[model samples]
Target: MAHLLHIDSSPRGDRSHSRRLTREFVEAWQQTHPADTVTYRDVGRQPVPHVDEPWIVAAYAPPEQRTPELWEAIRVSDQLIDELIAADILVIGLPMYNFSVPSTFKAYLDQIVRVGRTFAIDPEDAEDPYKPLLLGKKMFVITARGSSGFGPGERYGHMNHQDPYLRVAFGFIGITDITFVHVENDEHSSESLAASIAAAQAQVAQLVAA
Candidate 1:
């Protein structure tokens, strides 16, 4: 059975479009693949601590040379990386904040993208020093935005840092097989929101079935 790591980074809970869409996606996926297991994390509601100086040292230090204190500093990082490595598929709910991801999700990224764990940084090879370790994993990101026209060549496309940032960030860790399902116009009129939701639902169904 496939394993899924389901993460929701929306503070709005029930009112969050990304949250609802991700739930629907996972539910539909479960119905199709009943034996699949899911691990859930809500970083938006219960935020994780940001990386500190000690965390920085712990991440770059050699595993064999790390002291007990250094290990303690990266305990959460270790756990998060372990969970990430264990998952075959990742379904993340992302709500755009100021044209980017929430701080909570950023913190999660900082924790999981470890130097030696998720990737290897080699100063010797300046051309391709960073080698990603989390390979053969598929990612599906459901992004909710207040405004529309964030697609490529659109009016506000250049300002659309959310998905592009995500792609690069996750791609750096070897998860390049990523798909995005966007629900736009969240802060617009009721009709617009409903239409966005309906379109998102159809996309979710197709993605789950595929």
Candidate 2:
């Protein structure tokens, strides 16, 4: 049975489309894989601490060479990394804020992407210095945008950084099998919002079954 990590970054409770879709995806996944386990983390409600100066020092320092104070500084990062490494499947709920992911989610990302833990750096090897430790993982992102037409070759495609940023960050840690289900037109008409929600629900159903 696979271990799934469900993370919601939307600040809005009932009004968030990404939040609703992620819940639906997890519920459907549970129905199909009843024996699988899930771990839920709501970064919007309970945000993780951003990395500070001490955190930076602790992260780069070798574990064997770290002092008690240094270890304490990076305790949370270690725990977050451990949880990420344990999960085989990840379901993330993200709403576009200022054309990108929420700051709370970005803080969580900074905490988990640690050196010598999630990734490794080998300056000696010129060909590939940065190595990804997390592999064979799958990610499903439920994204909500205020406007529509952000797909490839669209007018606002170049302006859209939400999905692309997620892809780059997650791909940096070796998670290339990522799928996005977008619920757009939130700032538009009610009918459009409903249609987008319906389409997202259909996509979630198909993905869970697959």
Candidate 3:
């Protein structure tokens, strides 16, 4: 049975479209794969610590040479990485903020994407020095946005930084097989919001079944 890591980064409660969609996706997944297990992390409510000088020093230090204080500084990072390494699938609820990801979610990404853990650097190969350590995993991102037309070649595509940023960041660690489902038009009329939600729900259902 596959293990799933469910992460929600929306600060909103029941009103959050991303949060609601992610929960629905997980519930649908459970129904289909009864033996699968899930681990949940709510970084929006309980934010992960941003990287400091100590964290940076500890992250790059040699394991044997690291002192207790150094280890303590990276304790949360270690835990977050462990959780990511243990999961076979990841489902994240991402809400767009200023055309990008929320600060809390960015902090979470910084914590897990580490050297000698999620990725490796090879000095011998100048052409390709970076090697991804995490493999054979699938990821689904449910994004909520205030407006629409963020898809490739769309009207607001050039202004859309959220999807591209997520692709690059997750792809850096070998999560190349990523799918995104978006719920847009949050600031629009009720009819527009309802239509977006309906489309997103349908997409979620299809994805879960697949």
**Superposition error at 53 for model 1 (Å):** 0.5
**CA deviation > 4 Å runs, candidate 2:** none
Candidate 3 regions with alpha-carbon error over 4 angstroms: none
Clashes of each: 0, 0, 0
Estimate candidate 2's alpha-carbon lDDT, on a 0 to 1 scale.
Answer: 0.93
Can you give the lDDT of residue 193 in candidate 1?
83
For candidate 3, the TM-score is 0.99
In terms of lDDT, the best-performing candidate is: 3
TM-score of every candidate: 0.98, 0.98, 0.99
Clashes of 3: 0
RMSD of each: 0.9, 0.8, 0.6
lDDT, candidate 2, 102-165, per-residue tens: 9999999999877798889999999989988899999999999999988879989888889999
What overall lDDT goes with each candidate model? 0.94, 0.93, 0.96
Write the residue-wise lDDT of candidate 3 on 1-210 in tens digits: 999999999999999999999999999999999999999999999999999999999999989989999999999999999999999999999999999999999999999999999999999999999999999899999999999999889999998989899999989998988999999999999999999999999999999988
lDDT of 3: 0.96
Error of 3 at 99 (Å): 0.7
